[model samples]
Target: MTGSVRAAHTALALTNGLLIDGTGAEPIRAASVQVDSEGAITYAGPDSLAPEVASGTTTVNVGGNAILPGFFDCHVHFCLPGGAADIGLTMALPASLKVFQIAERMRTTLEAGVTSARDLMGVDVGFRMAIDAGVIAGPRLVLSVGIVSSTGGHGDMTQLSGINVLPYLQSPGCFPAVADGEDQVRAMTRRILQAGADVVKIAATGGVLTPTDRPDDVGMSVAEIRAVVEEARSRRGGVHVAAHAQGRRGIQNALDGGVDSIEHGYDLTTEQRAQMVDEGTFLVPTLSEVMGSLDPSAGPVALAKKALWQGKARTNFPAAVAAGVKIAAGTDAGAAPEHGHNLRELGLLVDNGLTSMQAIVAATRHSAELCQLDHLVGTLEAGKRADIVVSDGNPLSNIQLLGDPANILLVIKDGVVAKDRAGFLTDRPVSPR
Candidate 1:
């Protein structure tokens, strides 16, 4: 009974720690967290202020470690394999194998302190259901199901090989939604909505990974762009569209089309940055993927779009920070050179002109807002879900400490101790929520 969904009547107390509530507030030293076993935070503040715990409570003393809201990655494609950034190798792989690989990657991601993820493309409700049903161990997922793209854009993983890639889409979690005009875009949006997508992701511009396509190319026409956003907006639960935009004009076009967030704004301008602020569009800088691609160790094909990202991003990123543009931490995980290294995105944000605390907030609360899950996750306030991480190192002073899994001693999701590196508890049951 130790870790097996300690009964909802049970209680868990995490005491003697520094609390970083993920609200951009100063960290509280020697704090405590009280979780009423249904997994809601009963208290999260100064240690002395904690309410009296009922008898039979399980307590964890983190030895002055840091307790914070579990991190979130707003942009990831869990359906893709790590180091499969190469087109031919990725295309040649069978969908059957890739499907199971997602479950394994999900477990790896959860242990990496990512309690939740917003899969920009190629994840359906089945995986989410499996995780919730205790059939798999992974992050809580908000799926886009599949990406909607204009014929030759980024999501158009249509290969040069004579093999018909269209059938690939019929598989559960495959590449894209290709459409030419507004009618086609609308039809595809409805189809994806019926697939149980929590959001709709569109390729507003061509991208680095797609062969023979320039990252700066404004791929999708405006009418089609507007149609996708319009259709998604009309859906129940207020489904929003996320645009994979990199070029300056394309970034503007995406905002103009009412995209909720812009992924990889590499060549953004000051005007575009200001517009993003005015329009309240969140920026998910997948800096880790960009910088990792530039490393010679990442392979040549993976490096094909190195120049597309490297230069302008470095300059405009800091400018966006200065202009008050909201930054969200997201590593384009699952593609080559990136996977469990999502925590590396925080350090990249710091290197790209954010302070340590700002970077932490970006990874936690801001990223949640970007994915439109702010109401439930993000800040560690009373009544919030008990998704928490206990880190061995103080992430505020040296942000890179989070990049090491060795420092992450505990990961608890929904009142269950999913991972316990310190042996504070004898077992890790992690029963379904």
Candidate 2:
């Protein structure tokens, strides 16, 4: 998302394309969009009826390409490297070097057509600030900053032998909060909000990635979970709370405790889906990581953990969809293939019964709502931020094309051409296809 394409346009018009708009509506054929200098959409609709572009506007004929809102990943861990769980090695990386790796991965994410990312863990406030200030070309970042876990919980990162290794790992401005009581949860919730977390992630249950825990083990009590959620609500900007819960009881406790969303709800049941729908708790199935965890190559412990939960996830996801649960897209990007392959999640969702268009909506408008950025992005509607992706094929017809970044011809963020592989797109107007 750099080079000459970065700031190639302020007033821009991309016309004669198929626009999905991210609204779950049918694609508008012969579509167009006009973006103003402020990076807001001035017009979006049929190309024949598009408003005139401002004087000096840069117009590019899209040549019948398929345009859609930039994708969104509601869960990610950019600082955690792929395919390994050596806390000692990870903690030993110098802070400066870790930041460099995070920044570099962010660039790859942006070019992959992910314009907005909600980092659930392992990213610090500094990275968010640097991305916002344009110090690095990356997606707009939403940060949870640190994870909150009970002692001996999934995020504890402490091993047997009483090593107390959890304290040794820290991301510049990020650190986990280990608390056991309601008082500790309340106090730590305030501290995390004070630390500039846009959201809060509570490990309400043991997770697959941890060494000594079963996925069905509920970690935090309902009272403790309620404390964190209620305290986070009291903070300014109404910070969101996402619960990492996999067990049935844990998922129910997190929902009752007021978590805004549930991440990797591996063992959630049909009854739970009904409750989630009633409670309006969005579910982010990080299916990519679940798929990877079952890859056999992720090692015995990882594979064993996933073995207990994958069956339920494989079955429960479609049930959740059938029950009309609010579902968003997330890949758990750091779990496998690291960055640059988030689009694979859409294909996974489709494999689990979501139509290509439904999966696209899950990644677009729905994911935006989960990230608390629906007003700013997620759709190519007038007055929204001009974050759009142009793909070589009509993804509604061949959704798998997105799994390959080369099919992504262009990526525009805030009216700037962040990526443009389309040789025909230039400052001057061109003939329609």
Which candidate number has the best TM-score? 2
Model 1: lDDT to the true structure: 0.80
Model 1: per-residue Cα lDDT over 41-103, one tens digit each? 889999898888978888877778899899998888786665644445655678777667778
| Candidate 2 deviant stretches above 4 angstroms | 1-3, 85-88, 161-170, 293-298, 424-433
Model 2 poorest 10 in a row by lDDT: 424-433
Alpha-carbon error at 248 in model 2, in Å?
Answer: 0.9
Clashes of 1: 1
RMSD score of candidate 2 (Å): 2.3
Best by lDDT: 2
Candidate 1: give the clashing pairs: 83-336
Model 1 Cα shift for residue 12 (angstroms): 0.9
Candidate 2 residues 9-82, lDDT tens each? 47889888899999999899999988998889988899889987779887878889898999998898887666
What's the C-alpha lDDT at position 181 in model 1?
A: 88
